[model samples]
Every structure is written in structure tokens, then in C-alpha cells.
Target: MMIKQVFAILAVFLLFVFPSASLKNLTYQETDKVALNVSASDPDKDAFSIRYGSPLDGNGQWQTAYGDAGVYRLNITVSDGDLSDSEEVRLIINRKEEPPMVTSLKPSTDALSVTEGRMLSFSIAATDLNKDAPRLCLVPGRPERFWGEGFFLRSRLR
Candidate 1:
């Protein structure tokens, strides 16, 4: 009886102290799938998985598909897989794109202006969604690492 009691106490202690630690809630951005830039994050996550459910067409869960674009309910699940504690997040899949780019980059007529007692600030305007998002090289004749992105352009005045 004494041995059993001791074991029970240890078990209880472990259950309380080192319980199967895991994440609980996961969430998706509302702007996700709106511009087709769905992103997700989990607080105590260990792994990630995307399970595609039936679309408006009422088909089976789509784990993988191609060229299919519409309103689709996506069930994104993240799990520790050790404690069975996982989270599910819904995603509304929508694909967005711009027209083809067949033109070259245009040069800014405005030259670099450096002023004393003031910062040399300038704005850039571009049409490419990916390039103008501060990721691509914004400034002309500037280092690739020195570029800032904006909604319609990247603001890098160097």
C-alpha cells in the first residue's frame, strides 16, 4: 500500500509538473485568401498541416489540387503530436494575381538629393506586387540589401 501510494504521488506530480505540453489555439489572418496571401501562426506549436475541406462545389477534402481557385474552407491543424493537444484554424482560399509583366523597369527622373540638417527622403512607385513590397530592389544603383517596401512601392532613398 505504501509503495502504491508513493507511485501515485509521483505520477500525480509528473502529471502536474511535466504534463504533455502542447499548444492550444491557432489563428489565421483575415486578410488571408483575400489577397491570396494566407498566413498562420501558433503559440505553442510543434508541427503544421493543411487539410483542405469541401469547396462551394461540395466535393471531398482537397489535400492537393492544381488550377482550382474559389472560395474553399481550409482546415489548418497544428499539433505537438505527443500529447494529442492540437489546434485547427480555418482558411478561406482565394487566389489573386496581376497581369503579365512584359515591360522593363523605368528609371526615376528625380535625381538623388542630399540636404544638410535634413534627411534625403524620396518615394518610389512600381507596379509589380512582389517587387514593390520592399522585398525587391527598389532604389537604382543601390545595394540589394538596402530596400524598403510599401503598398504600391518600396521606399528606399539612398
Candidate 2:
């Protein structure tokens, strides 16, 4: 009876120690819609895995599919004699948005407009990647290096 109880406790410990519900395997085509590269890893080596929309469950072992363009779901499952479980992962396939273009740069050429009246001033244009408004920065020439480039960047000037 004591041995039986110890065996039961060991079984329960093993069952809980290793997370039974396998964290699903997934390969998103990049949520940004650029392209998709398959990446995956399994601790328990669950048999069922979906990579690039190719189901690898049969003797064929590996197959390839040109998954649809959009959010994709790769469902995963694990079974170990006593119990089984599953989970779904998300992958978004979208076009890669180009980085914003620096269309132009307008510098003051003269520092009279600046409070410092240092006679060295400038301005520029910047665009954001993904069309999500742009950000800018200017690094003024350090005092030691007065002969400098954009020490002050005026952001959100668009």
C-alpha cells in the first residue's frame, strides 16, 4: 500500500512538472506582411507540427505550402498516454511597409532665428516607416567640435 501511494505521487509529480499543454508551434509570415520564414522548437518533440502551412504528420514527413496572406494560426497538441492537450498560435502575414523617405532638408543657413543667435542653424524633413507619422533628431556640434552637423533636431515638424 505504501509503495502504491508513492507510485501515485510520483506519477502526479511527473505529470505536473512537465507542462502537459504543449505551447503551440507557429511561424508567422511576419505580421508586417513582408515575408515568412519558418521557425520552430519543441521540448517534448510533439509529433504534430505545422510549418509554413505544411502539415508534417505522415510518412512524407515534410511538405511546403504557400500560406495565404493574413493572420495564420498553427495549432499544436501533445499526448502522453494518460492525457492530451492542444493550443493555437498566431502568425500575421502582411506586406513589408517601406521606411519613410527623407524627402527634403531645409536649414536656416543663418542662426538669427535661433535664441542662441549663434549664426548656425538648420531644419530637415523625415518620414516614418509603415506610414505611421515620422520622427526626427538633430545632434548639434559639441562645443569642442563647433564645426558640426545638426546639433538640434526638430521632430514632428511635418
Candidate 3:
């Protein structure tokens, strides 16, 4: 009789002592910092451990997401010593966008004497925070006459 009662209690424990875990997907920028709040519950109302990683070893924390730009799969596991459950989320880090910056511009000649067939040179220094390529062009005359390097008419400027 005691054995039968023990088996019944064991079956109840097996049916109701498992744990459940859940996580939320997140998005971030390369230079962004964030924190995560994890959720877990056990049917037995037992104290569980929260884990974030593959194999769910319960070791992870939110901090900064700098220099790491890509998609990352994160796993969270909740364990109650006897039973365990797991959840997963995707964290996407997008590249940051920044406008191009011009630091300095210097002319090759301090005094300009323009004549026919005379070539003028200018030194330009610029940088793009997003590491994007930048181009330089010289525009002359009226605003309507402004054109890019390939389309600019040197003869008109002369």
C-alpha cells in the first residue's frame, strides 16, 4: 500500500514539476548598449536558474554591443535540478550610419594667377565615420553650371 502511494506521488511529481522558459527577440545597433530581462517559471514553484548560451549552462549578461555587427542566436534555459526547459531568441546588430565629414581643404598655391592652359590644384581632407568612400569635385560659375568631375567643362571655367 505504501509502495502504491509512493508511485502515485512520483507520477504527480513527474507530471507537474517541469520548468518552462521563454525569451524575446531583440535588435541593436553596432554602437548601442542594452540589457535583457529573462523570464522563467516552474510548475513546482521551485527556485530555477536562468542560463543564456548554447548547451544552456546559465552564463550570460547584457552589456554593450560595440564592434559586433551581425546576427546572433542566443539560448536561455531554466532548470529546477530535476527538470529543465529552454527558449531561444535572435539578436540582430545593424551597422551604424554616419555622414561624411570634411576636416580640411588646402589650395596648392596661396596666390592664384589664372591663365590659359593653367591647371589649379587643391588638397582636400575628409573622412566618413561609417567608413564609406567619398568623392571630391570642383564646381565653377553659376549654380546651374555646377557639375561633377566627369561632367564639368574645364573650358567654360577658363
Candidate 4:
């Protein structure tokens, strides 16, 4: 009877000490490489097999794919042979914003000032890594065109 009571108390202690698996929330950018390792615990010191569901592809520590830009609900399941548990992790993948590059601006530094009635020529060379070519417009912020006498000339690269 004493041994049974001791075993019950020990079982309760173990239950309190050893908890189930826990997954930490992850946040990453689309350009960054993502590899999330599962954290788990068991009373018997059992080895856990972890796998990710949804956007994350494949199993293993560094073999997961997280390239898409969105909020992904990653359900990671960990199994310790006999017992299995699942945990949900919110994986946020933010899109990478790359600034457009103005390779060269014509009407170079040498010719900075503009004349009154003379023909003024200006050209801009720009490129964007995300898009095929950088968008150009006459206005600084808005997309408007410059019209002359019977000719439409705007701030764009030809």
C-alpha cells in the first residue's frame, strides 16, 4: 500500500514537471531563409519527430521551405513513438521592398542650370530589381505627361 501511494505521488510529480511540446511563434521576411526547429518535452526522455503542415514544405531541421509572403499557420506535429502532440505557430513572412535604382541621370552635373527659351533635353536611366523596368513619369510623385506644341514629351527612358 505504501509503494502504491509513493508511485502515485511520483506520477503526479512527473506529470507536473514534464509538459507537452511547445512551438514558438516565428516571424521572417520573404528574402530570409527560414528553418524552425520544434521544441518538445516528455517524462520518458523520448525522441521527437517533427513535421510542419501548410506553407512549410518537407521535414527536418533545415529542409523546410518558407518563401511565400503571407501569414502562414504552421501546425507542427511532434511524435514520440507512442504519444503524439501538435502545436500551432504563426509564421509571418513579410515581403521585401527593394528601392528603385537610378543608374544615371542625364542633364548631368556639368549642365545643372536650365536656359529660358533654348531646347532643354533631359534623360533618366533607372532600373528595378523586382520589375522588368523602372516606371517613369513627368511629375515627381504622380503619373502625368508633359505636352508641348503638337508633341508629347515626358520624363521616361526610351
- The TM-score that candidate 2 achieves is 0.27
* Candidate number with greatest lDDT: 4
lDDT of 4 by residue, 24-62 (tens): 445566455555544556656656566678666563222
Candidate 3 residue pairs that clash: 51-58
**In candidate 1, residue 127 scores what lDDT?**
42
lDDT of each: 0.30, 0.38, 0.49, 0.50
RMSD of 4: 11.1
Tens digits of per-residue lDDT for model 3 on 57-90? 3334344333466767876666777666666666
Candidate 3 at 114: error in angstroms? 17
Order of models, best TM-score first: 3, 4, 2, 1
lDDT at 150, model 1: 22
Per-residue lDDT of candidate 1, residues 86-136 (tens digit): 223233333334333324333343234445676655443344333333233
